[model samples]
Target: MTQELKVINFMGIRKYTSGFSIILTILAVASIVFQGFKLGLDFTGGTQLEVQFDRPADLAKIREVLEEKQLHSPVAVTFGSDADVMIRTQDQMSIKGREYIAAEIARLGNGASLQDVIRPTREQEGFVDVLVINNLTPDQVAQSGLFDTTRFGKTIVATKDNTTQIAIEKGLDLVYSQHLLKELEVATGASIKLRSSDSVGPQIGDELRDSGGLGMLCAFALVFLYVAVQFQWKFSVGALVGLIHVTIVTLACFTFFQWDFDLNVLAAIIALIGYSINDTIVIFDRIRENFRKLRAVDPIEIVNISMTQTLGRSIMTHVTVFLVMAVLYVFGGELLAGFSKAMMIGVVFGCYSSIYIAANATVAMGISKEDLMPRPKDETEGGADLTP
Candidate 1:
């Protein structure tokens, strides 16, 4: 008679020991220490400067230009290799920066002069200040006039205070801001300072981080409860073990690379949990079926049999799913690239955990005779049915 094929017979290892699980757990802990996960500006709240030029620009050049203005190097990303560039600059709202902006504007153009170069920042109304410097002492004036004005027959008048003022068109010196500060210095003969216009608050990022952790906890606990209720306690325990194992491994990979952890990473984690559970369920279903089919078989051998039967299907399904995720990673654009990457890694490891970790855990979980055997038929004297 032909024998049932042992799918793992060709495979080198069939079981995962406690030692392997312990070692992986240690690695996962160390991951947190060495590779400190950094939050992205998206959840944290930072200024996002979008520059769309007529032509494609290199990131390196863009950074160099921005740094010359004293602006910190922005997190630069291009959407789908598009011509436009997105720059995330450091946050700055200090009085020092605003003070510097005023000084920088004054020295914008050497021969061209600040008046000629610095256009009004406001788009619609122009500011014309009519300061009566002759009548007032420096301390006498409470504040400088911020002239918001329009033109009259003879001269320009302040719209806000009705004071006479000068006309400065907006968007005049802004183009110079787009240029390298070095070029600005060379052309305008002024020392340009990089002013921080925006920064993300720690409160927002901290909230996200806190919520992400909570989300993970909630996700795992709920899943464990459901699986436990649906299957046996042992099945649920093993599934959770497999889950923790794969999650740690995936997180270790993330730490190893020092990739930025953000909302997207959390999304990936949730998705991974779902994906891994599906694999676990598939294997568990097979085991339940095998138990009924081979009631006489030992639990260890039965588990091995179940794993063999489902191996082909698991590999085929995960491979096809992985192929699609790979495509998404390659072409889904920068926004979703990290998410796709995490999913691909999860699929591979989740499959591994199901066969090796989950099955062995079932073995470790002691099985009673009743667990292996079906209930005996009730006789006329049902009480005596306990006889073996």
Candidate 2:
């Protein structure tokens, strides 16, 4: 008598596991729909100011001070250390900049009149504001050396129709930054120094957001095509669903917890897709191999054997990656917090998804030995095999 083959029946709880996955997916989708995401400056477009205090900064007090100064809805967080703080605020028009530009144009003595200073809108980009001049052409204004002063950031001269518009770049820093620095200094009284300052326009932010989303979509499509070609369409369907599940659930964690969703986090999510699909492919390959070799075994038994064989490898890989990500989350500072957090979440779900979501999906799709077996050559059509 042949010795009996032994394997853990991972699919024995298929109904329970499938229900759990479905429930989690629903909850994730609901959280994302209702709560949305707390977008960061990289996506929403805003001014970011990093300041260092001589002493440890009081984050709450800093927020209060900002409120007192009428800078509502400002986000203040501790950056690298307690003494350093990063502040982000929405778009702000620079009144002082407009006034300075107007005076400079008048002093140019070119009979140029400052018609209007229009603040940048979402539709317009690469400029803080459009300075409509009545008399001077864009080239004339540019050559006047009015904006050549170091006080301004960068200037661009352009003409739309007959009107000359002088658009200034690197906005919100010339005026708003100075005012913010002064107010923060007086309020904190800790001798704060502005370490860095940057601004991103709404148009640029929109473009980044769109591009990030497009990148994710392309990743999913490519993954599907690859799996379909390498394995069967059934395995590809399972892999695609597994990827979508992992991505959505990870994003839902961010939305529910209100973490800063920025470019770094977006990159982490894309990276996670690759990692998750890799594990799925490994398990799928094993399943395909076992299905072809274990001809006498049942479909479920073959899957169980495949999973049991790869369990140790999967555990080792995921644990190693998880530990690295955990270290990154703890010590990588605020800059990499979002990235590491996203990665950690992905590792956990990526493993689970490969086992249950992807594998179980293939099983549910009625995968069989014949599905993964190599097709026999049509000897009858190939000249009767041409054998003796």
- lDDT of each candidate versus the true structure: 0.61, 0.83
**What overall lDDT, based on C-alpha atoms, would model 2 receive against the true structure?**
0.83
The model with the greatest lDDT is 2
lDDT of 2 by residue, 92-170 (tens): 4354345555676787776777888777656567667667887788667667766653544677677776778767675
Error of 1 at 327 (Å): 2.5
Best by TM-score: 2
TM-score of 1: 0.67
Off by over 4 Å in 1: 1-3, 7-17, 56-60, 63-73, 89-200, 372-388
TM-score of each: 0.67, 0.72
